[model samples]
Target: MKTMNYSPEHLTSNRHLFWIAAVLGVIMMAPVAWIIGLSLKDNAELLKGTEAVFAMPYTLVNYANILESSSVFGWFINSMIVAIGQTIGVLLLSSLAGYAFARLEFPFRKTLFIIVLFGLAVPEQAVIIARHQMFNWFDLHNTHIGLILPNLSSAFGVFLMTQFFRAIPKEIDEAAMLDNASTFRIFWKVLLPLTLPAQATLGIFTFLQAWNDYWWPLISATKADMYTLTIGIASSQTNFAQSEGLGFLGAQAVFASLPVVIVYIFFQRHIVTAVSGGAVK
Candidate 1:
């Protein structure tokens, strides 16, 4: 077989596209770089306007103030509880729901799944008003339980796991059945192993969602001590008769962003593999 070589024009066009993409990537990253830069700078420099914003050297005072004086650490712990709790909840509930939907026969199952899919389209923000009233009625407001309740059943998770479960071979189920395995036994012993990639994918997604969830936590949390990172970040900026300096606020932002970023950096490959595995086979 003979291979056809690219014309000079084609090579030039490809190079042009590469350079364009590189330029666009840099453009998109500008704000992230600026935020990171500002996080290391001092308030005296930040409030001094544009010239100071650029002129000030980076410092760790912002980090010190955030750690020493702020309630940031408490918020970090609160965020961990909510994020981990919600993630575990989603993994448990959604996997069971997804498995049942994919493998089991039941009445009105398709219709029920469709309704659940409809639930996906309902915006989280749109439901906050009613949810707040219900939370208050249940006396769940300002509690960690309240922050977690609204997240326990996740539509996206159900859908993702459902699709991935369907992709698994039914022959595996039949083989397990031939061995006299109960449905639950088969699921735990056989099917679940096949879906680890999907589980990881779901776990990461759920963690990120719950970790970064701002509005739900904000509405559900009112007590200063009950505050998660999102609520704490907002609260960090102001209180009765006091305002946090811009540098301190910048540090709060950096602190809030760091953990998630660290998780991504370390487990990025696993996340990618899991997602790709789920998507492919």
Candidate 2:
């Protein structure tokens, strides 16, 4: 067997890269570690600065207290409903629109596509006032439906799915059609599975956006019963003059992030692959 040799210069370069990565990793994790430490401290220990955060007498009572509070659970459920609902709605609507744009013949196809592309440049804040008025007119304010309606479609998702669908070979569509498959059958049974990576990528983005959404929900969900987790956690912090409240806020931050962290962990590979594939296409 032959042994490979690394030159002194190459070894030094590798060491530099390793140290750079280590530093970056530490920088990223520092805030998370601090939050964890803060969450463990009791109310009395919390005000003593960073030094006392990791000190003795760590307690889970902060988490317990929040969980026991009915509002937390209600907010958690509302967050889930809005996030899941918006993700599903975006996926369905974007996929259908994407497929039509990529594979179908329609009048004013270019004009319509340009219009869709125009939406990409429009900021959410630009239309928010109009959206609020529209929802109010529909009597959807202070409701979960109001929370979800604004995010039900995504321009980016439609663009992503369109690119993915366009990258797929036309032969597949022809073959399905030859077999007497209807358009919906071809889309559902043939094309859909092949676009899993794109779908997962889009789903993750849509879910995260909806989950972390605060401003829209703040304006829409005026009722306490309809508050999403982000709004609820933020509102809770106003009463955080007490040290225990600080620890509770830290705990709530960690709890709120867990779903998104788990989702990214599971779908990270697909996201990477889908993005790379799109770049190649």
Candidate 3:
């Protein structure tokens, strides 16, 4: 096998690229670092100026206060339930719909898919009024089901899974059929396991979207007990102008983002694989 040559000019180019990437990485990470610094500083000190973040006397008082609040835990639980529920619902519905669209012959199959794709064009703002009215009519406001049901119809998830399923070879399905496997069995036992990368990518995104969602939850879950983390944190803020509240707000932002950060850290490999189109055999 031939080996790559490392000429002087090539080495210089490599060094330049490395420094460029380093600078960009630092640029992207600066804001996150700043937020973390703000979270650690005392609220009163932060009120003087954000420059206090660079000074000493950092403390955990903000985090302690967050822990002391009873409602924070409730909000955390609500967020977890909604995020996990939406992720599972999106995975199940999207995978099933994808399988049908990719493998099965049915009436209006293409037309139906086109209509579903149209959902991507329609912004949620346009439908929020109608959706709110319908939910109000059904008295679904302030309920977990109300919050979850709206996001379950994920057009992007369906599209991603459909493309992944289509990339799978037909021969696998044919061989499974020769074994007299039922259609559902083929999908569940044979094909589904092969789509783990896509599932991970989709699940992560769905969970993040659901967890960060604020607007729908703000209106749908008006009750304190039903508030998800986003709304709960916002409701907790007394005033942005107050110095004491600034640190707490920064702490809340950091606290709310921890789960998403942890999730990306754990499943980042699968995300890379999915984006790189390595999900299919």
Candidate 4:
């Protein structure tokens, strides 16, 4: 085979784009790395040497305090309950709704889908007052049940799944139907596995959103025991004051951010691939 050479313009364009991406990657990773570094340093070290950030002595005291002694574990469990529960809820319900919108012949599905799209723009903050009152009426305030209830369905999830569903080959559904597979089975056994990447993508997003949620949980949850890491870290600051509790605050913030970092490190490529495939289709 003969080698082919690119024009100077083409080579220049490719090089420019590659360097731009590299610069962006560095910019993004820098802050995250800095946060991790700060987390490792001791509180005294932190306060005595803000400018000596890179040179400070490191300790695991913060991590230990949050994970082992503080109410961090309780908050962790509560966050998991809301995050995973909401993620599963969104994936399951969204998958079914997505399949319906994509494959099933329904009346006014387009209008319904358009309405659902509005959920993407709807901020959780917008309806918090109403949501709080509703949870209060149901006696769910400060419970994990209350935390998970409000996020049970997501318009974004449904929209993402719907887009992915439309990309699946219609032939699979037809063949499944021919074998007497019910709608439920077809969605569960046939289509769902085919959409695994998208599911993972959605799951990661759902987990992050739930884990980082502060405002609703903060206001709705009146008790300290029900605190999430988002609120846990904040409460720690308020309890000790930011200047007084720099070490604990930094440590807790660092601790809270680790899971998401680990998750993205592992699942990032799958998410990118899934999203790319969805977009291409």
Candidate 5:
């Protein structure tokens, strides 16, 4: 057995790092805390000034108003549908493409992967006009499919899944082959289960991206009935300049973020594992 000792200087360095991290954490959380505080305060009080956030007499009127709004509820449902739809699509397509790219031999495989990677460099704005025109031609506008379709073929998802799949040992596949397991079976039963961490990471990111997406939904879902949470929330803001509804705006921000927070709470362990590159054990 081996023993290790930490010197006074090492301890001092660790202490400094702890304080630095604590300060940075506080800096990052300050805006979130401010928003939450504002959401609890009265709109009129907030109109007087943001200083009311630090005072007493907090209320839930803002949240009450949000809950009572039927349009907000519809928007929330739209967001959920789009986010879940897109996440599942991205995961399925990306995993299949990744498995093919990593494990199968096919002509133009490398070239095709290179082209897909090129998509990562191409900003969405560059092709937005063409995409919109095509979608218009297909009459996909103002539809849930319109919002979900654009993100289904995810280049980043493909890249991440491919790398994760490649990191897995090929011997597993070879052994499965010896047992006459079909390719789809090998992938579905043997390999896919091992990639749970990567799937969790990809699913979380895809859901978050779809949930927060505003620009595409803003243009595509022009109708109020079709609006996602982001567009709906923005449209609900009666006035931004005068802070006419400051507390409501704050509440919307907080309300919209609750889903993401809940998701993190449920999957934080898998997220940590994926980030630490432990997907392959």
Candidate 6:
């Protein structure tokens, strides 16, 4: 077979696109790079200003100090419990509700779904007082359950799964029915397995939201021991700033962000496809 060569114009266009992407990548990563440099620096080097940001004689002392003094590990555990709990709850409830809304016929189904859609526009802050009062009444304040309750099932997740389920051919359900499969059986066995991309997308979104949630946790989990990673980091950063300097804060910040970055790296492809597929629908 003969090797085909690109035209000069095509080659030039490709080169231009490559440069543009490289520029954008650098712009995005510059701050993160700076943060990493700052985190690695000693207090003496940090005091020398921006010129010394990338200078040598870096040390891991900042990381060690934060790890030693702070209850970051406890915060990490609390956050993990809340995030994973919320993600699982959202996926389970959203998938079932979504399938029902998409496939099953029930009285007031449309009206109920319309109400759920209306929930999308309701800001979380609007119900803060009510939620707080309810949680207090149930004695759930400052607890992980309280933190996970509000996020258990989001309107967006329900809507997303509903749309995706609708896109699947109804014939599949009918065929399952003919095979003596019940409604729940059809959903669990036949339909849900095909919605992996949507599920992954929703799970990632839920986990990130729960992980980074600051305001609600701030209000609910007021006790220091109950604080999530975000809240703990903010509080700890202040103490670190006063005693250990900004380098310590940078190290803690990096530590706080590692889980989210790792999650995105692994599931980024599924996220893209889920978004684009939803858009195409």
Ranking by lDDT: 5, 3, 6, 2, 1, 4
Worst 10 residues of 6 by lDDT: 272-281
RMSD of each: 2.5, 2.2, 1.9, 2.9, 1.9, 2.6
Give lDDT for model 4: 0.80
What is the Cα-based lDDT of residue 187 in candidate 4? 88
lDDT of 5 by residue, 24-75 (tens): 9999999999999988988888878889999999999999999888888899
TM-score of 2: 0.93
lDDT of 6 by residue, 1-281 (tens): 99767999989999999999999999999999988988988876666575677667789998998778658788988999999999999999999999999999999999999999999999999998998999999999989899999888599999999998999999999999999999999999999998887898899989999999999999999899998989987886656545767788788789889999999899888778766775215
Identify the runs in model 2 with alpha carbons over 4 angstroms from their true place: 1-5, 48-50, 274-281
Question: What is the RMSD, in Å, between candidate 1 and the native fold over all Cα?
Answer: 2.5
Deviation of model 5 at 164, angstroms = 2.1
Q: Assess each prediction's global lDDT (C-alpha) against the native.
A: 0.83, 0.87, 0.90, 0.80, 0.91, 0.88
lDDT of 3: 0.90
Candidate 5 TM-score versus the reference = 0.93
Q: 115-142 in candidate 4: lDDT tens per residue?
A: 9998888988899889888888989998
Alpha-carbon shift of residue 105 in model 4 (angstroms) = 2.7
Residue 239 lDDT (model 6):
63
Task: Give the clash count for model 6.
Answer: 0
Cα-based TM-score, every candidate: 0.90, 0.93, 0.92, 0.85, 0.93, 0.91
Query: How many residue pairs clash in all the candidates, one count each?
Result: 0, 0, 0, 0, 0, 0
lDDT of 2 by residue, 100-127 (tens): 9999999998788889888999998999
* Higher-lDDT candidate of 3 and 6: 3
Index of the highest-lDDT prediction: 5
Runs with alpha carbons beyond 4 Å of true place in candidate 1: 1-4, 238-242, 270-280
Candidate 3 lDDT, tens digit per residue, 1-281?
Answer: 99998999999999999999999999999989888898899887877788999999889998998899778889999999999999999999999999999999999999999999999999999999999999999999998999999999999988888998999999999999999999999999999998888888899889999999998999899899999999987886756655337777788889999999999899989777767867543
